[model samples]
Target: MFERFTEEARRVVVGAGRESAELRHGHIGTEHLLLAILAETEDPAARVLIEAGLDRAAAREAVRRLLGEGDDARALAAIGVDLDAVREAVESVFGAGALDAPSKEEPRRRGWFRSEGRAGRSPFTARGKKVLELSLRESLRLKSGHIAVGHLLLGLLREGDGLGARVIADHGLDFAAVRRAVEVTTG
Candidate 1:
């Protein structure tokens, strides 16, 4: 499948991995893919997104907040949810360090090896893989010889339930509008 990807399409896919790694995530999600697509300023998909008001920084921040990563505390702070205060309240109700109790679940392993035998690499989450598959489908549907950025964008939207698609929808970019833009750009 990768063999059919255009250079720019390949870069977008690779960039998704970098975005995931930068976010300290163990796997690439649909959100990471969206960020990567938005990062490719020269791509038609990216230009359309930009024209529709999706900035890379803001989208990345929004995805991070939505995923409840390190930014979770900051997002909570914005809503006046003092996590520290919550911890304190919990500790006051139950003894000290009550909120800090160790979990029984084993700690996840981290090293230069994984189940797929890729050294020190993360895998694509299920939804991410689905998006790629859909990209191929979109390419075939459009009678395109190679998978292009526009097809990838269509695939992301066609995936329907991916975080990337949801964020695009949240920004008021409906499927019809984006499809039209992509078609125009491709032409």
Candidate 2:
């Protein structure tokens, strides 16, 4: 699944894992992915959420509540999350093969390894990564070829108990609204 994603998407997954760990959480689920998406503020998907009036701070608070942790830095340190394990798990979830050398003589595809000077590293912050992972898993469950912005929107819905979801709901946004927007725009 990671292989099928663009470099940006892969970064989202990685970022999500790190953020999940910071939150003292053990799983790289959809909630983390949604947060990851938000963390990457400049990304189109993030822009969409922001435009939809999703409050990042509020969402974070909700996540804290969902995790049953108080709003303190100590809460983050309580969990011993394995970053590398999270990355590996993200790769595994996406069906990515080992990160080894490609077959000899295989022609490198255009745009492969080309960052387009956007950034040497991913723009996805740790929180954004969490959201992205959640979205990616959901997209896979729906058998999508690649993770789309729409998937991210839907992932926010799946995190119903989280802060982000509540904010979205308060804004009168839901999976159906997001899906309609995506369909109208993409179609």
Candidate 3:
């Protein structure tokens, strides 16, 4: 399916991985895909996003914050671990902000998007994968031979339950509005 993705579309996919990695996230969620699409400033999808009031980096930050800024802390709490308490204990022993310091071990930054393997990488979530699949459907529906950025954005819009699509809706954009915007930009 990826064979039909245009170079720009492929970059968006890879960029989603990089975004997830950079954010220290364990999975490439649909939100990361939205960020990747927004990062592609030259793409029509991105331009449509800009017009819809969700331009690049600032919008990315908003999406992350909206998706629960302290997600890891909450996750730890769910497993009967108080992250803040643990952090306080560590800080009392090592001094304040001890965890903020970088480790001497510069961990190797391997990309998750590498095709050879997916193990131990930030794998895409089920919804994220679904968005990619939907992109193919979108391309076919539009009578396009290749999956482009617009198609990818359309996929995000179509998958309305995903956080990425929810974010778009939160920003006051419905799927139809987004589709029309994409069409205008592509034309």
Candidate 4:
């Protein structure tokens, strides 16, 4: 299946891994894949998303908020919880990055001399893998011989339930409209 991926599509996958690492996330998720698509500035999919008002920074912040990263403090505040104060107290007692500790769910890979429990090295989450599979379906649906970045957008939009889709929705962009635009622009 991977052999059918165009170079640009492969780059998007690699970029998704990079994004997961950057966020210290345990597994590759649809949010990371969306970030990769936005990063590929030369792709027609990215151009269409940009023109539709999906800013990368805003999307990244949305991802963080959804994932309960440090941005969760704001959400906590809304409920009268002082997450910042709690984090500071916890960190002072447990040392820094205590709240950012890697989850046990992250698989440990045997390196040459040690185990690597890093984020990007982990496998994709189920939803993430489904999005890739959906991309293949989208390509075949479009009569495309190989998977392309545009097909990925179609898949993400079709999934319509992952954080990637949520971020798109948060941007006030209509999924059907974006999907049609992608097909029209990249077809």
Candidate of highest lDDT: 4
lDDT of each: 0.78, 0.56, 0.78, 0.80
Q: What are the per-residue Cα lDDT tens digits for candidate 3 across 1-187?
A: 8889999999999888767755656788888899899989899778988877887666676666776434676677689997657878999999975765343444455543342234334778889988999999988988888999988888888887888887777777777978898966553
Give candidate 4 misplaced runs (Cα > 4 Å): 70-120
Model 2 spans > 4 angstroms off:
70-145, 155-167, 170-172, 183-187
Q: TM-score of every model? A: 0.73, 0.51, 0.72, 0.73
Could you give candidate 4's per-residue lDDT for residues 1-187 as a string of tens digits? 8888889989988888767765656677899899999988888888888888786777888998889543455567789998658878999999976776475564455431122354326468778888999999999988989999998888888988999999999999998899998998566
lDDT score of residue 148 within candidate 4: 91
Cα lDDT of model 2 by residue, 1-187, tens digit: 4466656666656666555655655445455666666776666656666678764665566676666432344444468654446647877876553432243453444532222223222233334444556667767776777776556656556546555566566557676766565444322
Single out the weakest 10-residue window by summed lDDT for candidate 2.
113-122
Model 1, residue 82: displacement in angstroms?
18
Cα miss at 110, model 1 (Å)? 23
**Candidate achieving higher TM-score, 1 or 2:** 1
